[model samples]
Target: SGGPNYKVALGRRDGLSYATEEAVLSFLPSPTSNVTALIDVFTELDLTTKDLVTLSGAHTIGIAHCSSFENRLFPTQDSTLDPIFAENLYLTCPVINISSTTVIDIRTPNTFDNKYYVDLLHREGLFTSDQGLYEDFRTKPFVIIFALCQHLFFENFVYSMTKMGQLSVLTGSQGEIRRNCSALNSNLSWYAVDGDGHDGKVF
Candidate 1:
């Protein structure tokens, strides 16, 4: 898979039920998660450190809410952040209950590239998990590799994403395709098995 020329395997069925935010909170790494905490969460998804670093390149495009990185600026700016980067963030983010937006990638935020790795190296990463990749030796090498070679990052990204796409796969007749993308096709009770072998259901 490369660029928009790739096709994901089809006929995949949606989960019977969606996870509540509280239920999902435990599984997701916090914005301030350390390398260890991040590994624990990604490990549950069968993604390795290399995968974590490479996959994080997706942050290259998109905007983040201020709440996602405000802690790094307010109270006390994170020492890991470059002084100029932190100052810019403080100007962009307010400490109170307000919504704000900031680019995820400091370099070419409009493009999908391996610049995220470089951003991490420069202490320009938006989240702690991102900066952690550069700080931790285990994942740092991969970040460096990805930053130096976009081709390698692209290849690895395709493979990791392919693996991720297959993690919770179910075969024919296991579940029904949703008639609507936003809502379940039916309200009647339905069930499906997850990647971790847990049975999921819709109320």
Candidate 2:
């Protein structure tokens, strides 16, 4: 069987510097960000609404901090939630004053899976960003599509990722690839090598 064709592009440079804290706070999407907010962010980069829905599938991986969605657990939750789902999330993300340790994506917290959409149907989506995708009429259909078909979800996710990668990027000539992501320029930094080398670092 023939696999997808591949090509190499050279001269991709690393950015001299990453976004600052203020820059991140100003531009990074927040859990409380609504559909309009998401649209604005995507528009800034010329991404379409379809790309937005497809890229939003990134929620399939990673966990949301409890602080991001504690409101759903307290006061009242969306009536669409199954009782068992509500209780399960409540147990995993109890309302507490802890710094930032609780997680909301209970099922397959670290893996990329369609469970994120399943969580949405149950009103258990961890982030307002995640839940907002389902609430927005423009993206809801794609959300349902992703929920039902894992293969389709993966295909769209890859497309979205490809589009996202087209956004402004830093070239290696502009910056050095930090051996340690956590400690950007620490020469004494001890780096841990995983099975995939540098692939596991979040940023």
Candidate 3:
């Protein structure tokens, strides 16, 4: 759980408008994306290859739904996925649409660390986008460096995350600051849950 501490500049203004689902999907890399696609998406945001791999370390702390990686398991296994890890994934997700989840980082899932890079080295990365880091020449070096030296990973992560925070940022008087960060100041009901109460969909 312990990780690097970096100073983040304060008083960053919140956006008045929320991103549309289509806009978000268009900009972000997909779970099954290759390193090239990842690089392209990040580059469009003015992020470098180093930023791509560094920011990817955030995967060390989240859980991914089985649906995100089922393609690599069903039909044919991804050659990059470790056999033992693949078997365990099969146990959790025997078939597609099973509605299960697993930690993104097989090792140190709760920690913000370079273990995600280590996972890539072992071919245990949960997503194609992740494993593809090791498969690509551009990103593989950063992966190896992060795997071997966690301090460098932490240092780079802080820089990349800070750089990312500056992108598309709204400046003074450009946007309103809502009392509740989740919703607009005028509309408290930012999202609606279906009858099943499973997920909140943004309007």
Candidate 4:
């Protein structure tokens, strides 16, 4: 499939750093976070507001475990959530700690499309972080632009994904590879994208 491209640089080392619970919480944004908080997390990774909204389109085909959005149902539902949408989610999630899941996109849960942004425009966003895009003036335009045209969303998503994949990456034996390098590789499929230099290149 010919599209906006990013190069693949192989043999990069993976980081093994692990921090304490407090430190971990300091960086991870909550599902209920607002635009400001969500943008803060993206900025930490050099992602832009446009990238945040465009990448959010992935939710079109996404699913979330009950634990992920259960809080919205319990402890009084979130005011921003559409009442009809929340009611349906309650039926799916039912009681606290019940094991279940729900789709992010109400219109089409299995397509890579713009319906996620469309849902946000109707205040039907599943997560606070998602709805924050429409509620905040700074990011609302990107949501409208993507919702109106999926091709635009796809183009921006490719660039954003390529950018994210290159963050602090270590190439050319700069770090250690703890696992087997290639002994068991014959069991897996392999592919390589031959390409010229690009800012999106990742290992």
Best by lDDT: 3
Tell me how many clashing residue pairs each candidate has.
0, 5, 0, 0
C-alpha TM-scores of all predictions: 0.82, 0.71, 0.86, 0.75
Looking at model 4, the pairs that clash are none
**Model 1: per-residue Cα lDDT over 77-134, one tens digit each:** 8899999988888777857445978898988888888888889889999998889889
For model 4 the TM-score comes to 0.75
lDDT of 2 by residue, 20-91 (tens): 899878767787788898989988988888788777766666656667766666777755556787687677
Question: Clashes in model 3: which pairs?
Answer: none
Model 4 stretches with alpha carbons more than 4 Å out:
1-11, 15-28, 176-203
Candidate with better TM-score, 1 vs 2: 1
lDDT, residue 74, model 4: 89
Predictions in order: lDDT: 0.80, 0.68, 0.89, 0.78
lDDT of 2 at 78: 52
Across residues 62-156, which tens digit of lDDT does each residue of candidate 4 receive? 78888877777888988878899989998898888877888889998876678899999888888878888998998999999988987888788
* lDDT head-to-head 3 vs 4, winner: 3
Candidate 3's C-alpha runs over 4 A off are 186-203
TM-score of 3: 0.86
Is 1 or 2 the stronger prediction by lDDT? 1
- Candidate rank order under TM-score: 3, 1, 4, 2
